[model samples]
Target: MKHVTKADGGRQPFDPEKVQRTLRKMGVGAEDAERIAGEIAESVPDGVRTAAVLRMIRARAKAVHPAVSHRTNLRRALGLLRSKPDFEEFVRVLLREHGYQVETGCVLAGRCGEHEVDAVAEKDGTTVFVEVKHHVSHHRVTGLDEGRIARAIIEDLQEGFRSGRCVVAIDGALIVCNTKLSEHAKRYATCRGIGHIGWDYPEERNLRTMIEETQSYPITIVAGVSRSVSTRLAAAGVVTAKQIAYGDATTIAHDADIPLKEVLLIAGRARAILEA
Candidate 1:
């Protein structure tokens, strides 16, 4: 196999088995996975991009199973959550779907001091205070600063727990980020019983799995759409692709001042993607 360049500019030998394995992980049957791998191997030339290969596999998988495409490409969709405020809103939606009532950017007084909580969540008699650490890109990894963040959060939780902010008592202090956590931080959180929800934490209930479960795909998932346009759409309060799909394109165009033709196309693509 020839070497292929990755999106991060690293080079590695192309492996069709990797494609098949990913497909299988997405619930594709063995025969179909092998067939898809064969097609990708034949289609991709030497020196092709790994990202391009992924896009090809996603496209082909979408033809067979829609969830496969959405699940596989979710990290890219989530990377579109460029701003801290937007990431918070995305978390709100996610929590809401998970049956948690959420409040964002609230200040709670602890026994030691006042702490600004990123989000406060309540579900089934449990109250959770969340501190969101959002990154603009996947290149950033949280919890890499020698457990400084984890230690600080644990300390905050201690004060909050002592203060008795919740009538039923505080359940846990959760740190949710749009990227991964460092091993040290993970260990720290685990030891302290702090909940860490990263892009791929909690195994089954990661951000990608949650998004797929709720079908709340973000606007960034639509291919061929520029980040500028998606950012503008998010600014206009259209954060999810499902919103664009179910909404009126004309109204969106008039409000956002985007051309009606382009708005329609974006909505069409979103509808097709979610429907497939």
Candidate 2:
């Protein structure tokens, strides 16, 4: 077995099983899967960076199929929203784009106490308290604690209703995360009618689908955009591709300290993705 350096710089023997599983999950056909597996086996060097391996997989997958590749890449970008504040803002932007009015870090006084909700989404006369659980480590799974958090939000909703803090009736509580939820947590949420939107949930309409439908790719997804560029873009209040697409490239270039030509290229790519 060849040793591969992981993202944390730890070295471990490569697992071929992981390649097959990921290929299947990415919706690659068996024939294509075998070909991709062969390519991976040939391309990966001993002590190759895990991030490089992921890039290779995505590149090879894209060569095999564009639609599936986009789906896989969407999942990757969604998982990268690891920072708590960034993830919360992402959810707010997503909901707002879907026509919901959103507010974040809202503090409301319940009859029992004051509750701080990560986000509040309202649409069509319905209001929901959204609790965001963001984990930097993609391997971590959200568990029973999520259900507990949802239940707590529900309690706050109940008390807020009594205190007139909530003029309208609370519709439901939602748990949104950039990671997977444990089976027990999923069961608990379902039993309580609590909504969930993890990185990959509701098989058909997960976070990937949500972003694709809205054409709201994160700034981090832009080709040739580095972490520093993305951070600068975010600091300038431009978090999504849609935001960049609609804004002036010259101003963005000056503000982000990126060359105007490169900014134009990025904007073009963003528009192309949206049109695609």
Strongest candidate by TM-score: 1
Task: Give the Å error, residue 190, model 2.
Answer: 0.9
Per-residue lDDT of model 2, residues 1-276, tens digit only: 677897667899876667766675555678887778777877788888877877777777677656443333555565565465666777888888889888776876666677788878888887888888877676578888877867876777677887798554567887877777889988998899888887778677666667767777776666666667767776666788888877999899888778889778777767655654
Candidate 1 regions off by >4 Å?
1-18, 21-32, 41-49, 55-72, 144-154, 157-169, 248-261
What clash pairs does model 1 have? none
For model 1, how many clashes? 0
* Cα displacement (Å) at residue 162, model 2: 1.6
lDDT of each: 0.75, 0.74
| Per-candidate clash tally | 0, 0
